[model samples]
Target chain A: MEQYEKIYLYKRIVKAKLFIDDHYAENIDLGNICDQANFSRFHFIRLFKSIYGSTPNNYLIKTRMEKAKILLAKGHSVLETSIMVGFDSPTSFAGMFKRIAGQTPSSFQKKQHAQKNAMQLNPLLFVPNCFAENNGWTK
Target chain B: MITKITHTCIYVLDQNSAYDFYVNKLGFKVHTDAPMGEGARWLTVTPPEQPELEITLFLVAEGGMFDEETVQIMTTLIKKGTFGAAVFTCKDLLATYEELKSKGVVFKKPPTKEFYGYEALFLDDSGNWFSLAQINS
Candidate 1:
């Protein structure tokens, strides 16, 4: 491919990725993503996988799960989080979350809640020792 | 007095991947790509709009340019993402940020309004981060 063509292709591929980044909360699929990039399904999958190192569906699921993690950490219930991140069923959400995050939704939320409470109790305890000492905060 | 600084170096973990990141992702053009004996390459690239400056993509291999210990330490430091080597200016911070992010550039910061300018930070393939800024003039 010519240099300009390569640049154009990359711009299109990046556009598809940005679309996924923006609309991961929506019901997105291979067709929607490929439309954003102007590529056919199989060819788009090839290009997207080569560049981003994951298929579009996997990337979409990962994106939603990542946002779900933040929402879960912020004390949102698993059912609510699943809905928020566009998951239809909490069971599927919990299953996928466990697969990707290595813990059940409730357990992760509990850990985050415990950590938040502990931090609130002694804010300094959560601060890294080196970071505190760097500004003479330890002394 | 020196007329201009033409060349600089960024120590990379793997030269081929760095080439892909710089040329394919960042739209830099390869200025020089050649072998310097013993399976090492003397590779350099230039930003698309700035051909005058050659950014040498020096490989951190333990052979001719460095010893085994030095290579180990350098790789460790680069992997830790410690270096902030250069500042690249862009016309529009937000657009460039989005564009680069799509190309898999790992950004450390989103564009924010600092006193000096609107600046964001991103890491290259080999873990050397850069400051992408749009100065308020």
Candidate 2:
């Protein structure tokens, strides 16, 4: 019985993760998440928490923020990146970024540039790999 | 027409750790490490000469498409080291199983003959369930 519960829990976790990875940039709600994992809302929440230390809401935010950071680094504007990550309003997006990342989008981009500069300062950071040798994207 | 698979993406917290498991432990070859955006790394790999299909290594953070609850589940599973799974085609399933065993790869089940070929289950470093299949030639 306990083993079955364990397996059930495992499957739900996998499903939930899949839902997040696939739809992290969309408008997601608790009911939708539960439905995607094929679990009751109450059971899904409990099992999710038991397996993952954080709540579902926190995970979504983190995933979006991480994506935003990447997009920002890639030269996308704050508004563009915000919309790309499914934020309804730029203000809300900025607020969330400030809270979670401790900076606004512009500041984060600045930091990224600084970090890139520092990496360039270290010659060993740019060691050319044979696999990426011909790929235009890496260069 | 049965076209080749281009890529499959796996989200992870640590890129280097995942790379170690896929490349060093599982014997996959690193095919490319393209810069994705900002701090994100787009590391890809293939099996031997099978460079046509590559796996994308993605790093997960907070927000975006997933609500707080969904991220919690994925993060939890990833932390517990039981995230996802893959199927790798091998030249010799039985021999490969033995070799993986020598490398301390644990198996939940032994290889058995299926209509398609020989199949066996092994957990990746993060507890992703993957099967090794080698067709009888």
Candidate 3:
């Protein structure tokens, strides 16, 4: 496994996490993920957990579920939503959904849509460019 | 000699959302989208002005870092949203804060005095924390 001071190693782990985020929906597997972070299959898992506190699969599942919720709210059918998130079967998606989201996909989607009105930032919000003025030149 | 830190990573449930948040909202430039065999993607980010430097984001679940046991632990923290932090050097901390706030970036804490200089904290869409600071040149 690669070694750096804790700080330097952490920065590398972060870089890997970013890669996962950009392509989670695109059929990711373990070997490729480990390679991206420049770690072996054995070591990458431990270091990634130490740094980001989650296994790669869980992150991928959660990401898929999150997207599933959004698609459901948009009125996509349960089966469609299931496939959209990469689950081959709606049953599998439902089972996973129950485990993670605590409710059936349809129910969650119904509840979400029932909310009074959708605000521009209702689902989620990002930190605005509050630091633009201070952002200095790149190193 | 090693150059300054070029890239940083943040775990995300899905990469598309991460891309939207970082590129669309945070205004980071996408530096790399290399392919790792087996359907995985390698993504990176950098300040718009410094396109050459890139930070890669890896997708690891709670205990999935190295194997199943670890994935359990790591996924928990990642789901709860407490993992790591990204530090950005700023020329003027105050101005950056105001600009980010205007763009709808949420801040956990306002800028405050620190040994390094003025600093502020914010969270990305993935619940990863980041710091913005103005350091002496």
Candidate 4:
């Protein structure tokens, strides 16, 4: 009985997380997330952190940042990537990206483009810049 | 010396659900999905990066190796989470844990540092749990 209820709660929490993942591009907030799990904000935050190792808000930002990184790597403009990742303004997105990703979106995008060209130049080598550095393929 | 092992078996209550959980959710690749004799499905999935090893998803029905009584016992045990099937490793345990948790995988334990390494326990669709680990390199 107790175990069955526990599994049910877990399923609800997972559903909420998946909701955030699928709707990260939309204008969703913590209330929308907690509603999916049928829990109040405080309880949801505790359970979510316990299960996922990060609070729901933090998880949402991480997801958004991850998506922004992908968009920027694909040569999207910083403003465009910010909007696509659900940031209200490019300036705020730039600030948050720097805090979370440790570099401005524009600088990261530039680095990615350079890395792409470098990889193409060494077509046969076929390794990421970090991997190449670790392997001493680059000095 | 023995070269390498090719296959491992995990007894699942339902092959269809296992297929969904392993292939769809966990992102494993289906190596084989042919039907076996007597309504049994011979499904096997390989981890995305490790294509050489096939994990066989065996159905725990009252056919082939299992009789009716055995099937009943097995079903009870599996639902009760009696099996610790295997330990699966990843490059980053915490990231993988979060990813899998979001994919609806029910975790029995969160990631923790143990004497061997950092590991978390998660249940499959059929209640079979596995230890997900990230060993120090």
Candidate 5:
């Protein structure tokens, strides 16, 4: 492809991505996303996958999974996190989460909680000793 | 006290093309070019008139905040011209447009009278578009 053509295609793909990022919590479909990019559904899917290596539907699921992970880590209930991530059912959410994350939401949350507690117990572990010394800490 | 934005990202399809477009066509200065681990480079450039702010030429790839799936989505969006990266100001929009065009920069729209001022639209090497405007003083 020519450089200009490549640039133009990349820009269209970016539009679809921005739409997904902004509306992942809502019920977003491939047609609406393609509309945002001003590309037909067939061409959009083909080009999107060729450029980024994933289909639009897969991309949406991945984005939702990422957001769900954040909410789960923050101590949200499984049902709430699933709903917030736009999943219609907790069972489906759990299934997807396990497939992508390799653990159930509850297990992920427990691991996050343990990690949080560890960080809190040894805050210095996260902060450099030089930072404390520069701020006037003796030890 | 609040200061200025030190860094901003402009996602591009290719870093080499972006480098040529921004540095050669736009006449911007390279601020930083360093390795960012994981086969990514931290590339940033600054406009000639605005040295404090750095325009990071971030490549849209499958790393950092993106996974295999998310990277595909972002790459497609960028290629479609979905990202209007930023608005640039120039002392003379007409002269700047001409100069940039002479250096092989492609402008979607030439400098024309907009409601706010005279402006033009141009695409960077990575599919991110920007508005080159001379706001009315």
Candidate 6:
């Protein structure tokens, strides 16, 4: 391929990716994403997979799952997190979360909560032993 | 008070490839190349015009600030072109684009007139894209 043509192809793929990034929460479809890149649906799917090593739909799911992990870690409820991340239903969300995160949403949140609680209980973990000793700690 | 930004990072897949891309292709001057322990090196470069700011070509690996899971996620994200880290400005957009293209740099967008100015998008060796723009004066 010519240099300019290659650049053009790369740019179209970049555009499709940017569209996915910006509008993942919306109900995006293959046709819409292909339109952003100005490529036919069939051609876009093959081109995207060739470049990114994943289908566009899989990329979107990954994006949503990443966002859902952040939200769940921040203490969002499963239903709310599901809706916020564009999952159609909480059941599907929990299943997909387990598949990707190796646990359910609630389980992940519990782990994060336990870590937070442990950190809170051991406030001295934030302070250096030398500083504690200088400040008049015996042991 | 925070005065000026000194250093920023662009995560790359490999340091040697990044070195060739940034130094040999982009024509950036190497600011520091020192051992940083644990098989890592502190590699930084500065643009030709912007010597004050150093861009660290940080390698994405399973180590400091990145656990194994985080490294996996970052690797996937980087390969998918999820990061658009920074914008670089050149004196002449078309000339710079041509120059970089000749050096085997892969640009995603050629110099085109945008609403803001003349801009182009290019990918580094690691798939992180950057906007090369010359703002309207």
| TM-scores of all candidate predictions against the true structure | 0.53, 0.48, 0.45, 0.53, 0.49, 0.50
Model 3 chain B weakest lDDT span, ten residues long: B57-66
Please give me the DockQ of candidate 4 compared with the native complex: 0.04
TM-score of chain A, model number 3: 0.71
Better of 2 and 6 by TM-score: 6
Better of 3 and 4 by TM-score: 4
In model 6, the runs with Cα more than 4 Å from the true position are A1-139
Q: In candidate 3 chain A, what residue range of length 10 has the lowest lDDT sum?
A: A130-139
Chain A: TM-score in each model: 0.91, 0.80, 0.71, 0.88, 0.86, 0.82
> Which stretches in model 1 have alpha-carbon errors above 4 Å?
A134-136, B1-98, B101-137
For model 2, residues B1-137, the per-residue Cα lDDT tens digits are 97767777676767888888787667676655545345545577777548677776655654333567777788788767674457777765554665567567878778888999889988766556777887766
TM-score of the B chain in each candidate versus the native B chain: 0.96, 0.79, 0.76, 0.95, 0.92, 0.95
True contacts kept of each: 0.06, 0.00, 0.00, 0.00, 0.00, 0.00
Computed on C-alphas against the true complex, the DockQ of each candidate is: 0.05, 0.04, 0.03, 0.04, 0.03, 0.03
Error of 6 at A111 (Å): 53
Q: Of the candidates numbered 2 and 3, which has the greater DockQ value?
A: 2
Window of ten residues with lowest summed lDDT in model 1 chain A: A126-135
Query: Which one wins by lDDT: 3 or 4?
Result: 4
B3-90: candidate 3 lDDT, tens digit per residue: 6755555767667878887877676766555443344555677775577666666655332134666666666777675865668776
Instruction: Give the Cα error of residue A34 in candidate 5, in Å.
Output: 53
Backbone N/Cα/C clashes per model: 0, 24, 63, 0, 22, 0
lDDT of 1 at A130: 50
lDDT of 5 by residue, A1-139 (tens): 6956755666677668667867998988998899987898899998777655689899899889978977887799999999999989999999999999899999999998886676545444433345334323224
* Cα lDDT for residue B37, candidate 4: 33
Q: Could you give candidate 5's per-residue lDDT for residues B1-137 as a string of tens digits?
A: 97878877788889988888887678687766654345666577999768778887877777445678978998989988888989998865655665567567789898888888899999887778999998987
* Interface RMSD (Cα, Å) for model 6: 15.8
**Interface RMSD, one decimal, each candidate:** 20.0, 14.4, 21.5, 17.3, 16.1, 15.8
In model 4, what lDDT does residue B34 have? Answer: 48
